[model samples]
Target: MTTTPFSVGTFADGDAPPFPGIVVDGRVHDTRAVLPAAASTAALLTDWDAALTALQSFADAPAGAGIPVGDVRVLAPVQPPGQLFAAGANYREHVIQITVAHRIGAAGASEAELRQQAERELDERAAHGEPFVWTGVSTSISGPYDDVILPDVGEDFDWELELGVVIGKVTRNVSAEEALDSVAGYTICNDISTRSLIGRPDVPMMGADWLRAKNQPTFFPTGPYLVPARFVPDPLNLDITLRLNGETMQKGSTGDMIFTPAALISYLSCHVILHPGDMIITGSPAGNGSHYGRFLQPGDVMDCEITGLGTQRNHCRTTEH
Candidate 1:
């Protein structure tokens, strides 16, 4: 009695508008055919519990025979989430690499000294530090297969592949122990950034200008689909990998994260009411272009994947003037 594994996403055929679809065995079945509440992926998420039940039922006895996946255009699982929260510097190794490269906080220190200092700081932060979370405009989202149009203003566009968590129920001040219960599903996201625009020379004390550096259109390439939380056994143990033009650029395990997804969600919920369809992207692993002294160029391609969520392949092109 083996059950077919399934995920959900938005898709379109020919010129038809996007609709929520259940994906199983490389086939797409219109979710509306079974669940009228699924007018859109966002709408379906509003009642995620009921939606999950109906989706599971549909998976048990699917109708319409599901269309071949290749025939439809896959869109981002949730386009322009109601709210998008991103955690930065959550991975200890990534922080150590960045700290050593930039000489952060310990300027003029030797590389070995910087590495030792960064490790000690990470240990302290992991024991008592809150995640560095921030708001991101949802319009930056693009489909998994869409072209990432490098903005004209920035010279160093880089990739930061991350795990995206989708909120299911209304979540406020949830405890870390119970945070997983609030998750609807998980997806893959590439948090693209403009390295040159991250700092503000005009206001050095103000810290990194995340909005300017990261919120450009098509900067966030998310989802081939969203796998329900039930399908993922352990969010913190998945492997995250990314390749640029067929060369592996980033590869690390979620185990390296200083603040786990549940912790980040719990921390975020303390401040804001997380509604269904809101997204939280956990920070990326080490190996951003900045670390390697490489940056996106026209015609570059990025291939990214997490263990079970899915894969995303995006082409990079300069925006037309």
Candidate 2:
């Protein structure tokens, strides 16, 4: 395994077709000559072991001219993953945030009391509860710097910045201890949701409507690059932060996660088969728009970043279509 620190991403030069490139020292080197199978970043991930070896060799000594990262448009590292799984209520504080937003507590209880109650619930969950994983449409994936068009269907457009784990191989029924072995790398993703559309009161038996509430196009802002898992050191200890319009909004650490990536993946593998290039986004931290009661507005800019996994700046615009 190569220990050299490097990342992979998709980039294009001014209307030119996008190509996968090896990113090191702030420059992007085309992988076309280095790894013939790398038609896309997702393809490279299918055979991540061999691809990582070739990429490390190329990074050590680039074969050709490299382009300055700023000269080209950086796209989502994995345009459309094979499968996208999202974990909900995976952060202690985030669970409390959601519960408080929905008033899922004793009627007339104070916020402090509700918060404490949520904390107790979380402690119980950590001891006994299984992770709650859900499927998300892959088409919702968008480039890191892409504009988030607030769909006219819902008013509460929100942001939930998260840590995304990319699968390296076909895996099924893996244990938590071995789940990390299947992880190729990590990236950043903002799971944008429409708060107003989350509920299915008309058909209350169905619970939350994650599909319509979360799968809007350009909603899942992901990736500037995918940093190899070897460079991450400890996935659970990374810092997660999001600033809205230059003001700090969400600030927390991955350590606050109620379910670790491995635990979540292990739980998921019991039913769903994870394939190369599949993704599982661990839940967001506490400070989502719901916690602040301030949702995304037209022209709002959100700066999201995770330790090592590059940053994403997405501007929100109102879109009728």
Candidate 3:
């Protein structure tokens, strides 16, 4: 059993401004309204267990005592995190799919033999290679239900639904066993991408430019809820699903990730000190838009959800010229 229940965002109605909220038995308890001390979700995340303990009174209240769930406009549970890290190519299946898509031959002369050889190399890489992680600017983040404006210059607008790990404490050089202890909660993050912009022809020597390829405004739509880590026992087993206009586009599981959240955290902590409210999004599962030849366009709606984390629905709108 967990101390803190699922957390939600605040807003009396869809049109209202967002506030901090905690969901208890279908009711929304404003964290600020219930306990004057919790000013923001980010503040509570600094010491989530203690915050929950302090607000135990509200958690114990009757079902209907707080605001109705439907009445609240659920925003991103936390403010823009202090640091944002996005793991790249951390899913084994996703990496294999990319290799197959590009038709890069492997260790043999024949196609069938080449595939077998490729699989072996992939297995070896998974066993020994380190996770590829990238940094993302916080300004790219937007509310869960906000409109995602499609950049006019880029045609292939894609989505990568991932499990976002929220850091609860300052951690550095932690072991994999201790890494999970620092997690405050889990949230759904859509790591939106512009496929065409990934290539930098002139700066090929500089390698991939993630900044221009990924840092567009509203590129990351995160959180309808932040399911406290205590409530979610296994972050790696969650089923990740994303729907586009009622059709399922991406469906996979966190179990497929090559690098576990704990390993990623431990590796990241070795390089940089992770602080409370820092967000590290585990790599997306195999079914991104690039795989299906389906990309976002005006009027497209993306409804994405993980096993326990709440869902997010964002409408795609064309950028104003």
The most accurate candidate by lDDT is 1
Model 3 scores a C-alpha lDDT of: 0.82
TM value for model 3:
0.92
Which sequence of candidate numbers ranks them by lDDT, best first?
Answer: 1, 2, 3
> Which pairs, if any, clash in model 3?
none
Candidate 1 lDDT over 25-69, as tens digits, reads: 788999998887568999889899999988888887887678988
C-alpha local distance difference test of each model: 0.91, 0.90, 0.82
Worst 10 residues of 1 by lDDT: 74-83
Which candidate, 1 or 3, has the higher TM-score?
1
Against the hidden reference, what TM-scores do the models get?
Answer: 0.97, 0.96, 0.92
Tens digits of lDDT, candidate 3, 1-321: 445465645444565656778887777877876556767777877776788676665675533477777776666667645689999997877776766766667533464555566678778867897888999998888878989988877669899989999898889999989999999889999999999889889988988878987889889998877777877889888999999999988789999888899999999999999988889999887778898888898899999999978889999998772
Candidate 3 segments exceeding 4 Å error:
1-4, 10-17, 62-64, 107-115
Per residue, candidate 2 scores C-alpha lDDT tens digits across 16-97 of 8999988878888888778886798888988999998899888887776788998889988985566999999899888888
